[model samples]
Target: MKNIRNFCIIAHIDHGKSTLADRLLEFTKTVQVTGGQMLDNMDLEKERGITIKSHAIQMEHEYKGEKYVLNLIDTPGHVDFSYEVSRSIAACEGALLIVDATQGVQAQTISNLYMAIDHDLEIIPIVNKCDMDSAMPEEVEDEIIDLLGCERSEIIRASGKTGLGVEEILSAVIERVPHPVGDEEAPLQALIFDSVYNTFRGVIAYFKIVNGVLRSGDEVKFFNTGKEYEADEIGVLKMDLSPRKELRTGDVGYIISGIKTSKEVKVGDTITHIDRPCSKAISGFEEVKPMVFAGVYPIDASDFEDLRSSLEKLQLNDASLTFQPESSLALGFGFRCGFLGLLHMEIIQERLDREFDMDVITTVPNVSYRIYDKQGGMTEVHNPGGMPEPTLIERIEEPFISASIITDTSFIGPIMTLCLGKRGELEKQNYISGNRVEIQFKMPLGEIVIDFYDKLKSISKGYASFDYHQDSYRPSKLVKLDILLNGESVDALSTLTHVDNAYDMGRRMCEKLKELIPRQQFDIAIQAAIGAKIIARETIKAVRKDVTAKCYGGDISRKRKLLEKQKKGKKRMKQIGNVEVPQKAFLAVLKLD
Candidate 1:
């Protein structure tokens, strides 16, 4: 057990954590050839150049004739998966904090640093991407030392691309990262950090053994569900499966039970032997809940089943992805899906298209609102279509977020402008490094969850990075803005916005919808309103013609008759005309700023 070292790599996106993992695998000879960021084996991951899911693998390395077991866990670098990072840290004894040498500490890097600290894990700071032409190892090293108050000599510099400091990194794991401690003779207890649904093995729970030992014949029970299943198989992941009869304490591996679904074995659940169950379940097991909600509908109503099947397959791997059958009068059969954030929502939508081959349309993402009624009744509404009437609602509470932003000195002005416009409350501002600034703000989740990231990138010219976590709900004056076409409300076009900007947003939405909606045969009314009161309106005129055709020398009577006939035709068309709204029109409202 002293030779076993369990640790994970934490970093901001594109910091070469996966590359470093590949090098570790190569140096340790875990595989014949180098993995080359092969830890990111998902098709979508390779295409997008980002780690979406956290992965774990076991490796064996020897130094001075002593064999060491290094179980390295790779985590997603994006802030959208902070919950995953927390789970990964809980399953290990230490973390390798990777920061880019060129970019220094980013928004997510600081956030991840705090997570590793909160877990009380031994942190090994390593400056990655040292081979880059723009590498500033000294500047980044100073940043790390200042942030963590560690010795300047303690920070390690390495290049994942060139394999520099690879051996030292391995040695650090053996010498610095503490050996995991657990009682092998006690009750079998394992912390499940992740899980997957396998066709042959059913639910394969990826766990780190915390106490006792797990054998193939043992019947295990989930602490949260209180359900028991036989351990059909047990193995460790090293590129591929390495089956074993037993997984002792301090080992990280998978337990194959007949459990067929991902929900059968949750990510943060503890599993123990049925006969010798632990008196108490492992601590630090947190249930990940979704924060962002959006309505996902099949482009073709007939493909709803396919969409559902696709989402199920995805949910098997992604425990945080949630969905329930939702009926939309405007969009037909669909599901109300909950995601961690915008990137998560994006990945799921992309997966449905690539992995499931289902074309789907997603409504504008929204945060859950706490609705209070006149009679003291309270409710939560995620979809604007489900909001209670304005008169019935006494108050509304919107979700707020504590946000952090890191940017170069050159872009501070624009970054602040964009943030304040989003109803942000400045909390703190300071220079983290010589030319880099970190800003903290408290903002309404509704404001930034939509296009705040995009706007920030545009203003900073892609030099700024952002990360935010959900905070406590704050009371706010909110209104549901509805779009009307010829006096009929479009359910999908309904959205919730702060009442202060409702008039301006409504006017802009009305204008954008008018520009996108094709001209109809008759005059169409495009109105944005709150309840029955129209806040903004635009009129789309019908196609008109001179009707007095080939009038060589038209007299007053002839022209008057032609005009009267044209007016009558316009009236007839208005009575029977039904404006055909294009799909793009509904989508245009999403981009209406």
Candidate 2:
């Protein structure tokens, strides 16, 4: 039996995880298997610079006269998909903890590293991107050893971009990482880590053999659903070549069963021989929960079905994503989508626009809010449409988050002040890596929903790294502010906020909103208020006139045609009672100062 090596690559966002994967594929000559280069097919992934879904690759190498198959799993870096990362780790025996030489370790690095350790994976730390001018390999190495408790010798200095120390890193994988052990004679069992779609081949599930060898044409049943199917093809994902058949124990490969839909395959689902199935499915697979919610609507209402189909296709590959159809009284038809976090939402939107060619309009992201009704019934509302009436709601609790900020010592005071202004409570502060300081605080998720990163970047000069997770919701005196244009409330501008800052925030936001929106032919009044209490107001002047000045008899038809077009265009504009609202009005409310 050949030795088996199963490992995952874990790193912070933009820490060169996918770049290193591409380099390894090039190094092992696996790029030729998929025509020219397989990694090039990851177009959507390349644009984002982060992996939204987990993928596996198998490479063969001979170390010290022993041939071995190395299964490498790439995981998502965004916190929203941390559940996927955990599942990938569960299927692997070790991990290659990649750290950027210049950026060192950030918030995500700490979270993902802890996940790897929780899985009891042997970690082989590597410092990547040493070829860059700002690379600080020695300092980062010291941080890894001191903060992460990684061994000094096991930390390999490599440049995935330049292909330096690639061979030595591979050697370390063979030498330091333990091999997966499988009972070949026992009942066949494998753990599905991920799956993909093909036009001709159907649904192919990528998995690792946990015990016994799985052969082609074997009848297997999924442990989660108890559905049985015949494994028609068993093949490995060759680096640069077509899939080669006959993947054995401890090997990472895709199995094409008769099942054709991604819904049939799930992460952590155990596949076992039907005749002699295992006693129980592998444990430790946790259901991924969404932390942020938003409404996704197509720019063109006619493309609603297209948006739904694209979301379904995305969901097939990503088990962590969740969505449900929703309709707003004012926004029309849309889907209430659940995401891992803000970054996940952006990635999904980008993929929808870039990959599926769909233009989407997304509402501001919101955390789940608790509503205590007057009759004592409590319910959680993730969408504004689901919120109950103010009279029925006794109290509203907003979700708070515990955030950590790592920055230079100089900007610590400013960051703290910014956080405090945003209703953040100081937790603790400390110094790490000798010079860098780490600050922790608890803040309202609502405050950080929009432009938090941009503000932090501006204040810290782009040197601070931030991380936050949902802290428990707390009781607060809050109000649901309704913004009105003319005499009607603009549904899109409605948001939950504290009563104290309602007027100032409302006036500032209305002005910004007015700047974003185009003027109509009539005057519009932008007013912010809590129920009957007026907080702030602004005026959006209307266009003086839209009529054609010269209307000659020869151009009467042309003038009529022009007027007809204008009338038709104005028909698409939202009319709040007697007021004519421009098409840009909906988007304008989303803008924050």
Best by the TM-score measure: 1
Candidate 1 displacement at residue 64 in angstroms: 1.0
Off by over 4 Å in 1: 32-36, 300-309, 401-416, 427-442, 456-475, 514-525, 537-588, 591-593
Instruction: State model 2's lDDT.
Output: 0.77
Q: Please, what are the lDDT tens digits per residue for candidate 1 over residues 80-190?
A: 777778888998889999989998877677777787888888999999989899999998898888788899877888998899989989988888999999999988889
Relative to the unseen true structure, what is the C-alpha lDDT of residue 22 in candidate 2, on a scale of 0 to 100?
72
Candidate 1 lDDT score at position 1:
92
lDDT of 1: 0.85
**Window of ten residues with lowest summed lDDT in model 2:** 32-41
lDDT, model 1, position 302: 95
lDDT by residue (1-593, candidate 2, tens digit) is 44788998988777888778777777766564333224435676656556767777777777788777788878876655777788789888889999999988765677788778887888999999999999999989998897677678879988877888788888988888888877878887889877766658777787888888887787889998888998788887664224544556777777887676557777789999899999988887777767667888877788888888788777767777889988765667889998876667777887788778998777766667888998888898777657777788888888899999988788988898889988899999998766678899999887776557667867976667777778799977777777777767766557777777677777877777677656776567778877887778778776755566666567578888878877665555536325534435544444455
- lDDT of model 2 at position 331: 64
Show the colliding residue pairs in model 1: none
